[model samples]
Target: MPGHLIRKPDPCIYSQFLLMQLNQPVTWDNPDVRILSGGVEQYTYDLTADTEYTVEITVHNSSRDKPADGTAVSIRWIEFGAGSQTRHAIADRVANVPIWPGTAIVTVPWRTPATPGHYCIEVELAHPNDGNPTNNLGWNNTQVHAAQSPVDRSIRIFNRYPRDCPPVDEGGGPYLDYRRAIYGWGALGAIGALLYAHVGHEGGMGHSYAVSVLAFYAIAAAAGLVFYRLHNERLRPRAAVARAATGGHADCHRVEVTVDSYEFDDATGKDFHPDTVFAGRTVVWPAHVDPPSFIFQPGEAFRDVTFHTDAPDDPGPPGHFNINVRQGGEPSGGVTLTITRGG
Candidate 1:
């Protein structure tokens, strides 16, 4: 011990922020918030780029120690730039807490970096005496594409019934009613005709019966065709089936997914980051969506552009459905969306 260096006491103050836990699934502040038609929210929504989407995250306090009311929750928004280049926080938000395990929601107002690329939203709790400081911080990654004409062209699949329906007899309802009616008409027509042929009456009585049978058969055929057209080969009545089993309408949980930007040409005027080039730029998706329990993993060669749950039926014409976007290993943040009858 040459010269016995005097060590100075640590001067940095530290407090354990709220610990992130799963009291309930963390999702966007408002995932399905609809911007009204021609309203201010809609106007602002339309004017801003995709990066302008404010990410609101909800965190939970698992620790027994209650976080003081008005404690600050720090949120850091960062962009992962091209190859080893230094990057700094694009924005920061400090959300005040009402109590631990309560008021855990934080809103990062700044638009995602103007640069279209992979971005991360990191949330941390600022509190002292936190037994585990390491757990105070967590992050989630998402890709920001050049804004398109239809800002959010996400595909929605409605299919929560299959998961919620009871195991037994999940089929029967308006769908079944139509199917039964079709079968009844066809069967009655055939039986009536066969009986008339076997036991004929005099003077057109048999013809009259045969004519009635033909009418029934024609109606049945028409009904069948209508059903086929409405419910195409790939479409399944999963929601109806669940409703029948549960004696209530199946929840229409819309799974909204992010649509990818395919190109960065002159047509894409928003693509104006001089430091970065869009050509050959790869997007990094969450390794898993709603992970640990439900995971969607696109292989190494393929970059996952969208995350969605299994749809009950084939992709139908664009329509509104309840949407939930859970980035794997990260809290779900709501994306500003403008819904229309058709997109």
Candidate 2:
């Protein structure tokens, strides 16, 4: 009689479709289609509705699983719309596929829905041993436009803009660039009037014109003053300011930049008042003779604490500075200041 045949142990099957004890799990790397001219892999693809296209996905085995035959991969498509529809089994399976500890590319045919809309593609692996469900899925969004064919008058264009770069000078432009000629003519007219008034008149005859020139000069000066005050009030110079904790304290802290007898200036430092203080954002605190302090709390390092000066004429030196963290005597990490603009 023959001896009993010895039995062999079955090989271990490690599933990579889910997260296992290991950190890395199987993933779908890039899902894309070649529809554009450059053939770049794009998450968003434009598709003509009611048409069929080829979609491809890369399946990566990031686990310590060994390659096995007869492994399956599943693919699906989701349409985003009123009801949010989903199409299952865009590709039912890639049967008898062998995948190792690397990546395998799978291609399938995807037919666009009859109705034009936005859609997404989902690729998944069917490994039974996959424990991490999070990384096992991948998706892509696609834009579907109405089918392109013979033009129909019934179709309406919802958005419109000037596509030509050069304006026709038909009266207006999108911006102020076309007014160069008008500005030049106005400047020449003003210079010609001034020259004619100066050179064309006798001493006695020039009196009235002199008076007119004086009046014009006075008006111009007044306008200049008004604009100067407006500019100073509106545009305050800003400085790059940062504050951080020098000590290794884990607790949060506050920094205060105090101004005496004034408010904070605007960020541009153009405008100054006794009632406002420009902090990280343009803010106006109440005015006080004692000194108004702008306070900011920093939970972490490198907080922007620099503020524009409240100087009346220009951003002169800020008066009565206070940099206290956690209400303690002083902070090891003080503020550093840098001018953001040249005078």
Candidate 3:
């Protein structure tokens, strides 16, 4: 211990620096989509964010309606922002219908945003589907969410992952945690052995218990490595998990849902606004399909439509209400409802 001042730096230090940079996760998109009118055509995808991706859209006509041999069609792109401002849309393509039940794709280039976050890609059809080629076409939007990279927090040797999306099996039981720590200590233990060897050579104690010091260092080094890896690995899922859970996390709040039209009987229904997200900040429509069937109370928390299914049934059908949550220009988290019966 007295002559330790002349020791050299640990060779594993470089590993430590590399491990830090490898663990943060990049972003991804969800790509949820919808098309206008009733038809068999739909978009299918197994998506990823860190890779170059492509999208395909096919419009199939209702068996009942068929276009004369050929028709015209187009696809458009709209970017939906988090807060309650009008989403920006960029027209992408328009082409002649090649098949009766046709399929096409507008390649969404892999261009990362300047700011890091999730973004929804909305595609609207400007031309009609094959079934009703004469009918005007419309636009719809979908989300493309990102995934996070993994981290290396081992004490001795660092584990570096670029994105936050930790591998599903990253979690290990107690035995595994200890195994990693011991592994790291193994690295440091090497240095300890070198010191012990130097000291033993000068003292000529090669045949004594002084050599056991090497064993002690081995165990200590491993425990540190294992402990470090386990700690950082637990936190990588937070970013993407939050990204997938809720919507409109922007500063103001945004709720916008595209729709065909609203149906009402002439009472409280007359004032129903399909484009206006209830208090005006959430996107809650697009004529949301299979909107949860449920009842509502007058004073319950009104942000999530999913919560409506839990609401106490009202006195009558006239009072039924439903709509998407609005975030841009009105009440921050509350949602608008389309009342079906009890009013």
lDDT of each: 0.36, 0.36, 0.32
lDDT of 1 by residue, 1-343 (tens): 5322532111111111111133222222122122233323332223243545554555444334444333345655543210111335634444444333343445455554454544434555554433344445544432222322223333222122323323333234456646655776567656755665567542244356557567657666567656555654324566456557954533222222322221212111366553332232212211113221222222211112333322223323322222233333222332222222222
Candidate 1, lDDT over the whole model = 0.36
Candidate 1 matches the true fold with a TM-score of 0.29
Across residues 254-329, which tens digit of lDDT does each residue of candidate 3 receive? 3332212222221123465534322222222222413222222222222222222222244442221222222232
Clashing pairs in 1: 15-127, 15-128, 16-127, 16-128, 17-125, 27-332, 28-332, 28-334, 254-322, 254-323
Q: Any runs in candidate 3 off by more than 4 Å, and if so which?
A: 1-52, 63-91, 98-102, 106-110, 128-323, 326-343
The TM-score of predicted model 2 comes to 0.30
| Alpha-carbon runs more than 4 Å astray in model 1 | 1-51, 69-72, 80-87, 93-100, 143-313, 316-343
lDDT of 2 at 335: 16
Which lDDT value does model 1 have at 130? 38
TM-score against native, each model: 0.29, 0.30, 0.25
TM-score of 3: 0.25
What's each prediction's clash count?
A: 10, 20, 84
Q: Which prediction has more favorable lDDT, 2 or 3?
A: 2
